[model samples]
Target: MKKIIIIIITLVLFGSCKKDEPAPIVVPIITSINPIQGNPDTEIAINGSGFSTVVSENIVKFNGVVAKVSSATSSTLIAKVPISSGSGLVEVSTSKGSANGPSFTYIPDIFVGGIESNGSKFVGKYWKNGVAVNVTNGTNNVTIYSIAVSGNDVYLAGYETVGSVKVAKYWKNGIENILSDQSKDAFCYSIAIDGTDVYVAGSEFNGNQYVAKYWKNGISVSLTNGQVSAEAHGIAISDGNVYVTGQEALPAGPLVAKYWKNGIATSLTDGKYDASAWSIVVSGNDIYISGYEDNGVNYARYWKNGLTNALSYNGNNIVDQIDQIVVSGSDVYVAGRQSKTALYWKNGIAVPLTNGSNLSFAHSIFLYGSDIFVAGNEFNGTAKVGKYWKNGSAVNLTNGFFDCSPWGIIVR
Candidate 1:
């Protein structure tokens, strides 16, 4: 009787111990992810169960590439979207198991500036998210060289041939505003806006020479004395100060790279070699200009507050030019062409966007978050087509059947 009672008690104890043991490990279950869509580097919150408390052990991926996990808990995680990610499912992996969340989409708005032919003449136009809006009425040959967007307003600067002269003009939301009188030939190459004031920079013929000039709210300010030929190719405004960049043609001398701050001329290079400033931008108090200088050969260069930085090419006699510039945070980006190949430089490091099989040009660059966008044209065997590249992947704005060129870009 004592043995039977002892055996029964032992069996009851063993049954209790078995009942107290934990169940099998449960795999993570991802219910959802906040902000189902965003650009690259966008931070997202993941809600799931059975995640690792240690963030490094918790693996998050957007389309198989590992994402950067900032923080992780047993049931929550914060991860930054990877730069190489596109529209795909977000997956979370832990030691327990892996689970997939909802799909994440990455889409960004893009604007491109260029010209389109209307049978007989080229008409100035710009595309917003792949839809084209006409800047001109196709009455005359119009060329749009630059574009700027502020809030809901759109501005395009270029020239329209009127009679025998090219009249400097800019369009504000499809309405034309003349910057120069029809008495002399003029052209506007760049446009900028500050608050309520509109600024247009270009060249005007004054019967004697082409004068580098900028118009602020329709008031003209000449950077040159009209005796020497000069042209303004880019304009920027910061803290009530106006900046314009171009080249001044001295009498019988090479073109000089120059910039004007509030109508005060500053020479970036002497008139010994041919140099031109095609783009200008101001970040904080630092000024940057992009162009090319002829050091026996045309070499791509940019000046940061008057200090020169040169870009490298493949070989001798290869021409390079920087056509546009933008400063975001502490990074400086310049877009241009090197020996007919499209490229952009980030802080003086060249990133080629195209192979040298055909002619390609990168005319404008814009950075939205961690995404880099370049707008320009690429020759598709038969004709040049307007297109933009998002992180080196090309998106055509125009069909390859027609010739088009993109000169400027902006992303908001």
Candidate 2:
């Protein structure tokens, strides 16, 4: 009996000495990613808790593309963006568990910029895949005429009217940068970003006439001599050369469609009719410009390398207007209005976007791979409706409760 009591005590003591099992590790939770978007080989840090301490045990993927991790800890991990990674949710996996972080938008996402009226005033806005980013309040009238995205920065060109003064400005990631003060009214009609340089083309009031001008990094360079009313409506950069297209108002004559290369003007039309150039694009050794001319008929046309081609339509007593132009590979595209309907042209063939029951207009065009996108507006019986068309399908950006219009679109 004494021996059995001693054995029971030994067993009890052994049981008491046994170690308690470790608590199960919490699942890995991802709180954020620094500099969420970048090209291949871009190092990004993932910040969160419950990460594996062993560097070799953590796995990171960007849209299914495996990322090479450099270091790991309980709350952080550093990884490089995998080559050929597209935009999608970023996931981090560990032995404990896996977690999803915020979506990292790949560079070259589709962006649209424009304005919307809210019964009282006009507010400027831009969108990244239908998510609205309001750039202004309705206190003053503002417009966003163009959009350009480079790296992780977004630039918008337009003007804001404060009382009687029109202010030319551009927005970089929603922060306004003023280009014109109250000295004279100004309008920024187009913007082009090359590396870190910002170029804007427009017109600023010069005493008795509006002078066509282009600004490089906010430094003004006049394209016309301010002797006549002129406007620079479109800008393009290629092969270390700057090209701007618009019209020069001839004294007591019609507006002439012309383009300037490095401040030298090239006439595209005879001074016999009112012609305007709205957009320009340079591809290889060719230059393409789109606009309209009133030669007894309002004809929508595009000029290619100083040649001309008219976009055809079959409507009686109707007018056509071309607002934007784009060129891809061997194809040329233009967005504008046909009669009272919004439409686009591919290689000079008209593709309608709306029925002719109300007034509509197409202002911008963007091509992605094999897909075509056009931003415009349609009058929905009661109000103006903003629209973005993919291929032939239309996506309305706003309900028909107020006036809204999209003027610029870019699909990187």
Candidate 3:
């Protein structure tokens, strides 16, 4: 009887211990889902609470597609969108119940044609069969002055003034990146891309004069501090050296056109009125810089090897700027505006894109293989329309509502 009573007591104690065990943890709740449907390569952001120690494995997928978690916060997760083509619906599962987001459309692959220049705006568009297609509009709010292309990525340089302050900005793959934090003023006039690094050249104001400044990988480099009040207008990368061109202050209170190889200043012109370098080209060991000289009149010009190339003089008046340069086999091509008309030169032969009455100006040039593309604006009596030319034939790309223009072009 005593042994039976002891065994029963032991069993009762074990059952009581089992009944007192701790309960399972309750999963945190997800509050909201935003941009539920996203295209491939797009980032999807998820918001919730109690995500303090969230891991990639914690991210569950009901659709079976692998989603890469890019970043995570205490209450949010940034994940790379999967190749969800058919139906854009995605269901996310976790230790808690599943949550679903709506379907989103995929962004189509764009074939880059090359960059083109309008006077103040640089426009990039896709071209097919010698015609412009899918031209980006609403570019007047921001000016695209110059462009550089590497692979399918395109970079732009320019400045936009919001009220009294000018801000230097650039765009990569069509996404805008502001380089300056100044509430005063800044401008990026030229852009160059070497491998994956992007560089820009321009000027930043320092009280009285504009200081020469450039950026490498979005980092600033001031070639001229505040001493001489220099300006950097063009930038190019050849071999391994970075070349920039513009004007420097002189003792006589005028600017002299100059270029720097890896920041080593080299004077290309010594004129007093206003000498500026707008574009640069490199061929083998030869470096060519183009702009205009304000002697008695504004003349389109360029220089090679510190010596003036005979082709520098294009016989234009009151207006001239070389916004871009490209080397074709053994020939060189330069594009800019000459006296309110779009102008291009190949091997020293000047070709006008429009009559002076059109008030058109080409700010950039692109040569893909044997084809050439130009971007700018077309004046139609009352307003200017954004336009791109493939093979010298003009095609309007935007309506005249906001004076849009193509500033950059690339062919991929």
Which candidate gets the maximum TM-score versus the true structure?
A: 2
Best by lDDT: 2
TM-score of 3: 0.64
| Cα lDDT listed for each candidate | 0.87, 0.87, 0.67
TM-score of model 1 (CA atoms): 0.74
For model 1 the local lDDT of residue 369 reads: 73
User: Per-residue CA lDDT of candidate 2, range 1-412, in tens?
Assistant: 9999999999988887775657777888999998888766678999999988898899999988788999998899999886547788889998778899988766545688999988988888888878889888779999889998876677889999989889999989989888886688999999999878999999999888889998999998999999999999999999889999999988986999999999999999898998988899999999999987788754788999988888766652234678899999889999988778888889977888888789998999999767899999889889899889989798988897999989998875
Candidate 1 per-residue lDDT, tens place, 49-162, comes to 988889988889997878999998888899988754667898998888899889888665577888977667888999988999987888899889999887568898899998
Q: What is the C-alpha RMSD of each candidate to the true structure, in Å?
A: 9.6, 8.4, 12.1
The local lDDT score (0 to 100) that residue 406 gets in candidate 3 is 59
Clashing pairs in 1: none
- Shift in Å, residue 304, candidate 2: 0.4
Q: Residue by residue across 3-96, what tens digits does model 3's lDDT show?
A: 9999999999999999999886545445655665544556766677544355663563414566777766667766766543323445555665
What is candidate 2's CA lDDT for residue 180? 82
